[model samples]
Target: MTSEGTFCLVLHSHLPWLPHHGSWPVGEEWLYQAWAHSYLPVVELLRRFAGEGRRDVLTLGVTPVLAAQLDDPYSLRTFHEWLGHWQLRALHASTLWRGQPVLRELGAAEHRAALHATEDLETQWRHGFSPILRSLVDAATIELIGGPLTHPFQPLLDERIRAFALRSGLDDTGLRIGHRPAGIWAPECGYAPGMEDGYAAAGVERFLVDGPSLRGDTSAARTVGSSDVVCFGRDLEVTYRVWSPKAGYPGHANYRDFHTWAHEVGMKPSRVTGHQVAPPDKAPYEPALAADTLRLHVKDFVDTVVTRLRRLRARNGKEALVVAAYDTELFGHWWHEGPAWLDGILRALPEAGVRVTTLRGALEAGHLGPPVDLPASSWGSGKDWRVWDGEQVADMVEDNAALQRRLLAVRPGPLRDPVLDLAVNEAMLALSSDWAFMVTKDSAADYARRRARVHTERFGAVLRGERPLPLEDRVFGQLDARLL
Candidate 1:
């Protein structure tokens, strides 16, 4: 328990603007998976921590695109229906497995989880964006940082797009959360040499970058172009300690396989046929066995945290911060047992006496290391921005870039006050991650095309000044003239 040991479990929550039609590959389903694993469960975990009166700050990032969905009446209604459906499915699961002792117990747990998930969704929506989470930010239990208006790829984007989106994001977030965010998620954690100037204009004090950006420099923050905006790297070693791309604990052999698929039988549901990754063994998600698996991973993670932090106490003698940031979608969506794993990790981190802090909280205390410049980088694969505008998605990126430039020329300059709202809309429309992800995954080509067309067209409309309504110009126009 050294004074220097501290950690920030920073979870970045975002989905590339999946509105009414974004339900298939890159839309509503994405929300359901994230809602199931990351948001609801994370909320419960933080709620428990708050109830325990824990003083630690756990950072939760809610991107503006995701915020719009949460605030949308249609999305909320859809989510309610999704919740109700899952509840019934859980009941079906319980009844189907009633004869098997172990499976029955697991089904019962799912049923309870289903019920809790619904409550958590409503609770979060009831406040516009998880009042508990918002409260945590205000109380500093969780540092609430936001991303761009629609979570765009910044470096490759036109600077105008970067300015409009980030500024609008700050404004919307302040409106929703009731306070200004101290840190920006930087949309995919993307950063470039002079991008900080845009952040600086938006009154952003700090942001998240990646390791290569730091280039082993270990500098916590550095200024750009006379702007005091500081950027922090993802602290890779500590982050990989929990969820590495290929070697993290979640991928262990004994963990409930995430690749398994199931089919509901006619009179009797068939057992999980098998796992695709681990092929030949498909036992589905057995909570009884999975609990042991979760415990193992949690202990290993906490042990690593303790060992690393202890070494930090010896090396730096300053408040040592291990910034372990991750995609929130990883918790429940990608990893089947992720929610349980997160619950285990959160509970374990505090009990082991490790200090948990957020990006904002960590900055408040200051860094001892000298400020070294970070390279242009992101939290994407290889700490590069390839996923956003790689060769596969280059055409899409170029199209958006050209559109962005035209929009700026026709509508507003970055410094102009009149063009602020239009800039906001086009900025958001350009940032939707659909096309890039579609190009990357290769399975959602049509879905991506549809989304890009939708937003790109929306941008064109704004540029032409054909749209007069605010919410509609931004979010397909809501009833009663409200901006969801």
Candidate 2:
């Protein structure tokens, strides 16, 4: 597998801050899913790679909200408890899976895998956060990216609301890791015409967009229309090869169905009948066929990435970069075997003579040929803002407009500290997608509302002149307790 130039893999990891306001089968659960699936597993894979003495240079955008949760003593504690819960569930599942003869041996294997994963979590937590990710960014193994404080859909929100979110995020990340970031994920990959000025203000020199955002400007990095900040878009072909709406390699029939979940609570033993059933209604846990299927899926996905990258290599005589970007949740969270696929592919790329690199590493190598005026665009649906703020999300727009109006009135001044804090806090909550998602069930609406309410209340208390917001520690403490 030959790569044209410096190939970069960027995984944007962000979910609206969902700590309290537990609303259900979806709410705080999303956080748990990320912890159980994506965060912990990916950390394991990367750490394992690091321990092997191979420097796996990859770029992953972890938003400030997520990073805060990660570094927070509260969040880490909750993460530990979640891991323990997963262990118990796995044990529960094993009991059910062993009942089936054809899957008994497979169930045993899955049980062993689960146990191994649980044991690995402790070591990963010990490996520490600043080193694995922060150190990588410091040493330039990874290009770190931040987003609005709570991850707001820019362009839709007022300039100050958006500005505050951006500032808080950049500021917080710096506080956490002791380094300033140069790029942001732009929540939902959302962007506006003049957002770059704020990026410039926040010390962010770059932001990501879709292929169309670059609009025929095939260069390493292109400047936004009349703006100094650089913008880069995802190459749909390379990205979709691994993740797409209908045809991504992850949907292979052989692999486990992410939505199938647990019917009767089994450790292993899937009940998929080819690809005819909806994910929610699928059968019990099945690992026998799932493992073989995952193996093949990983092989095919690696081949697809290799083939397309090689073709790009030959087509573009000059060294060109083939970047594969995706949501971090897709791995471990959406596709159960995704981390395995990633681990396999990351290893395979170098073997095929493709130099593994991160966004920062690649950009540092050289500029994109020349600069073209990039369009005002995003990586959303059809490379637009429909995914986050489309025809379907109008109500959420109205809700935020009022919230922003209220916040703009408060203006962090000399009056009351609690009043100002509440306004700022709620303003931050207003930018989150939880409420909007709750309004639209296309995703986890219930969980969305719960999360939205969480930040809103936190902001309200401070605004009510509670100055210090006594409940802050209580709320955060519960999160800490859950971890233990």
Candidate 3:
């Protein structure tokens, strides 16, 4: 049934700086996988919708670091090479697994996926992502959401540094996307009291927070504390319906199993046949079964949104707004069928009589309410800051706080020092909330700790007035030359 309320989908797209980082299990390979399986397919899907005249069907947060990587000349070259390697790996897999019918079929599917990604890259993404992404923003197919330069958790950052990060990030967005964004994803939806003022000063008119931030009263957009900037709380009820930390749609039995990777090529080759099934015992993936499952989940999600909005309108006696946010990488990167599902949902929502709007569009439509005081929060465990600051990551917290103080104290001269500029860049990367999150979750904990240390040590060296490390000098010199 039709409802007067609106539903907004916010896709928060972000990845840490990975150009010079390691590859394989993590690093540049991570970037390539997301680019091929997630970004390419997702953007192409959005383009298809735009062809049919869809506008603002969803909101997208493409963090500045991610944007830089997509636009970088070095990244473009390496990504092309990575795509070639992917196809080669698939070809080898198809040949090597010939005796095993199921494995051979899996290899063939991966080969087709690789070829498709290569073709998309050549036709649409050959030049760079800036122009294509800008076109979408121009067409209003999506509203761009900017965030801090390196996805720093603004809540814990020093006030001035936080402001600089936000302002610099917005400026970068303007440079790359042809306009400054009016909204931001706020780096993990992490919020501290009075951050509304920081966002306001940076000219960001709106942001998102966890539903608990608004005390779960997300019936309408809200102005926080004393600031006029609007805040939209992510409705956990709707978001978790698709994917949550512990469980969600991607775990459906018919979907591709992410954990059962092929030893030779590291490609996933099995379906999530059952929760208790061993990787070796899991059934082979079947596209037909997955297609059927996708339809069911899509309908279930659309129906859920309709029912929730209808109930919310009835309870409020007014038009209500619901925002469902997620990481953009989840689509093809983690869930093999994610892009198709997204394409289906975007088309079905409007047909089902549900209104699709960007968070900015919602506010402009006047779906707003009085100011509310928000509690310090994040879209993390316990709906608070524990994941980034709890016992597991206490050392990281101390190191980040120390580095922020040191970096802020040493302002760069008007004439840029390549050393200082590079140091500042590293410091920003070090402060990324991803490190602490990985540590807390025990996922890639060692890599996370090492990355945190390397950046901080580089930042510390520069702060101590020491010369840039040898490797730093060579790397930053090349980057400096490119800027000129």
Runs of candidate 1 exceeding 4 Å displacement: 97-101, 122-124, 217-227, 265-280, 313-319, 350-353, 412-427, 461-473, 476-484
The lDDT values for all models are 0.67, 0.65, 0.85
TM-score of each: 0.86, 0.86, 0.94
Runs with alpha carbons beyond 4 Å of true place in candidate 3 = 1-4, 99-103, 463-484
Superposed by TM-score, candidate 3 places the C-alpha of residue 15 at a distance from the truth, in angstroms, of 0.8
Residue pair clashes in candidate 3: none
Q: After superposition, which runs of candidate 2 have C-alpha atoms over 4 Å from their true positions? A: 1-3, 105-114, 126-132, 138-140, 216-219, 226-228, 266-273, 278-299, 306-316, 414-419, 437-441, 446-462, 466-484
Give per-residue CA lDDT, model 1, range 244-361, as digits (tens).
7666766655555554433451111222333244444444455556567678888888888778777766676554667778888888666666767777777778788876667666
Measured with C-alpha atoms, the lDDT of residue 135 in candidate 3 is 90
Judging by TM-score, tell me the better candidate of 2 and 3.
3
Candidate order (TM-score): 3, 1, 2
Q: In model 3, how many backbone clashes occur? A: 0
lDDT of 2 by residue, 227-316 (tens): 677777677777787787667766766666665655454332454445777665555545556677766766665666667656665676
Report the number of clashing residue pairs per model: 6, 14, 0
Residue 428 shift from truth in candidate 1, angstroms: 2.2
TM-score of model 2 vs. true structure: 0.86
